[model samples]
Target chain A: MNQRAAILSLITPAYLWLALTILLPLSAMLYYSFLSDVPIGNREVSWTTENYRTFFEKAFYSELMLRSFKLGAEVTSICLLLGFPCALALAKSIRGRTKEALFLLIILPFWSNALVRIFSWTMVLRGNGILEYSINWLLPGTGPLDLMFTYPAILLGLVHSYLPYMILTCYISIDAIDNQLLEAARSLGAGKLTILFRLIVPLALPGIVAGSFLIFIPVIGSFMEPRLLGGRNGTFIGTIIEDQFTAVFNWPLGAALSFIMMGLVLLILFGFSPLVRRLK
Target chain B: MANVSVLNLSKNFGTTTALDRVSFQFEDGKFFALLGPSGSGKTTLLRMIAGFESPDQGSIHIGGKVVDHIPVEKRDIGMVFQNYALFPNMNVQANVGFGLRVRGISGSEMKRLVAEALELVRLSGFDNRQPDQLSGGQRQRVALARAIVTKPRVLLLDEPLSALDRTLRLEMEIELKRIQRDVGITTIFVTHDQEEALTMSDQIGILNEGQLVQHGSPVDIYENPQSVFVARFLGEANLLRGQADGKNVKLEIGGTVKTLSKPAYPQVICSIRPEKISIQKEQEVHRSNGNRVAGRVNEHIFNGTSLTYLVQCGNLVVKVFVQNLSGEVIPPNSSVHLFFRPEDTLVFPDA
Candidate 1:
């Protein structure tokens, strides 16, 4: 075969799979979103903008969507705050087998099934669970220490689930930076704080931005953790979307809500991309 | 600009010694080059001076203050890294002005000084250009400008020009020397390139195997290297193993070669630089004052400026370079005498 035919033959299978799996479902969802009702079992289904109009008209759906986005922003902030220093330590201070071991431990959560991991957090964070039990055992009459199904518990779970993504991206970026740059800064009479503010943060901005988006995008769409760990308080945009499909059986409304959520995520990502490019 | 000195400085990397009781003084406003082969601890010494590494047992003094416990930032030194570690996100102006800005000098004053430094390195209008936009040589200039903009007491360059091509290296070398002279900041440059050290430094300190083997002006070190390592490392040397007499070594190549220094040992190593040894068809009466070795030319290498003859004598091949002024290329297998003045021969212990 000639070059063009050979290239087409090699790429056709993957492209076909993507079209069948992702593109087809997305198109179906867009169509389903505009219908007045389900087209099934001889029910009269008519085209209408009612499903989308309900979204703009109702405060509940818009509130849940905003709440879901707020959760993403909070979790991503905590992850960056905690994980950046950990990554810097791994990249700059630790070395040899020790660094390898710590790095493996950080990403260990990613190797396991995410659902299993979410289930496991309930064992630790639930009322009278390991943390509460351990605390009461240490300090006799400190009470039940009820922390499960709270906002903080949900935040903690999300951060725990995604901290590794932040760390890995940051470690790669920090590791690529030449140690000489830091030394050069010091030799030029820059204190440690100045070096961090002036030299290190700007250089690692791209990594921080990438890691933030990776963690934020998934956390926004996540339903499993909110259901298993958060209980009633986890009823955010994601859980509401799940309700539209399974509980209410309103696939059209779910599709409209999903599209709106996707638009907000895209808007946020575009806002941060210019800053990333500028730093680079 | 102030004098810097280290006394009995030493550094060890676990099982291996990187620098051992090394000590030297760099005078104010003097350009010093620490010359050595790779892994000779030249860069290690330079880092210690820059306060990047603390010597296990030594005291460093800058100007007149002991700065043994001082951190690199507090020590007020400037370093140019081998790779020219300019801030990648920062433009040339920001990089140069970093030292001054961190010192709390801001606004137009900082801008003026940075501009002055850029002009000094001959990078006047490159202030807005990021480090990525510059070529290898231009980046090198930015690095130099950044280093000296703070009027650092001492400028430490760690093989800053090794990344450039030959022509660029030479150009940067001349440019660096001119900048160093103009600033009059005490400067110490570390390099494994001997020609660089020879041409740019007021004083050259040679290091070998974690030890300071010799330190002197370039002329003194080049003409009178005290050890086998220094003699060979500073420039090429044809070493002949021999037994020492009062002022000469009885060569292993079946001849007596004259020496400049009296050897304390019975056996010695005699080193003579290639260019110092002149090749002649036969020894003339006036040339009898110098030591002589007879050999057949194994091969002749010709360039427009110089000619090199690989002469085989006894069991060894010795290289000799002569200026191409005569415009006559010597043929291979021709018998010739290798002549050198007795004072040009260097004697060292046979270890």
Candidate 2:
């Protein structure tokens, strides 16, 4: 009993810190969602359900949420398709020092700040940037192309930022496969293509599911990619929430939108949990 | 039916040669075992025959056709891995039917054949269960069913019984021999267990250092080993290293020693199996015997059915086995006389 109490005492500090830092803030945000922001002469102090009501009544909020989901799905699917094959190649072909070097290359972009990584894509995709210059050079008479502040740029940055996560998870999974299983399949008269689909893919499915969740959730909540690259036609829910918090000073509405986003994240997790269990 | 001929095979990984120039032949429908320690290139040779490996320089002929360049799937060969590599996601039926399905046979015909193969290995009604749900012996039987379903021209087993328990390994060995005979498929098995090789193979090829040291029937290899390594490897033997003079060999033991048969060369080593040595009472020992040694038992081990004695003669300690009669027992630290017939001794060229 004394030992148990001592262990609990040692863990108490971290427990209190987590509750105060994480749980309390999230709880406060949930509470704030039910409150309404009113206009006073200089400041506002009112409590009502109008903020939640306004969000539910507006179709634009729902459209932004749907659009974010669509973009997140696209980014996740593209990352999986490209990342799985790249990871398989890396796991199978590279060895020793070369494998370490390739792994380092995959994770090198993560070392830089996220905003800088997003901005780097802008320099290349802008109207007068390297992509436009290349197109003009290749087509000769073609004028400069405009790709700045577009959906493609945002999608590109999302995939670029999250692909390493997918690849690393997939590499770890694929590397755990026993080489003898592949040989056994071949000996049973399975061709290389059959082995890939029937053996390798099924065995690596858990990694795919894990990578999907890692890339999808973050991409949906991302604000910088859409904010930097989305022009007049492009707007995501994350950017709208950012606008409400910083530019408009509408903390109650922002809190409502954040709660809605958290609900959507939970829904997405609910949808994916069955799939993860099935893969296992 | 297939006869496999490996001619002048050599494989090198980087600078280290895993297999030297090796050659052997397995007649059709014969159970051949390649017996060796690890790194003796037995598995490499088996892999080459199964078409998973291509030798740097060699010609392999199965059914009198050169198959050195053929891919594994095109060779019509079945292999059982040591780990019993069954597909984890598939049931036993699907795994057993995989080869048939690959060959474009499916539906009722595939089902019948898979059932028949599973029945042959005595694994019926296990088709619906996954591999992990089965016992080790059951899993091995499923692996065998999977391999034999396609009626392969040649069956290759790479240490298949190595993962099973001792009793299970013994039972599976008999099962494998029976199945191989019943199917009449030419089979080549690779194992490091000498007893398994001696018991199961119609012909045993003893390999050492990537070279085939001896290839013969189990009896010939065991009774007439051509090298000290073979005699020591196959079973227990007491080696007497001595100088060869004409047709007579001289031993450092306490008696006059003579060779049973003279080799063309001089300077030989002789090996005597422990079972061939007879222990006699002092009064029953004849003085005019061809070879006899005087020794005292240093240690005795009672092995249920037999007693093994470690006897010291002069400066050499020799092991001898005595069958236990109903009431016979030998205690340790007892005086004993060891005798052997001259022709039972094996003489090899000096290493």
Q: Tell me the tens digit of each residue's lDDT in model 2 across A252-276.
A: 7888888888888888789878877
Correct interface contacts retained, every candidate: 0.96, 0.73
Q: Predicted candidate 2: interface RMSD?
A: 0.8
lDDT by residue (B141-172, candidate 1, tens digit) is 99999999888899999999999999999999
List of clashing residue pairs for candidate 1? none
Interface RMSD of 1: 0.7
Show model 1 residue runs off by greater than 4 Å: A1-13, B245-248, B283-287
TM-score of predicted structure 2: 0.95
Model 2 misplaced regions, further than 4 Å: A1-20, A38-47, B263-265, B281-288
Q: For residue A136, give model 2's deviation from the true position in Å.
A: 3.4
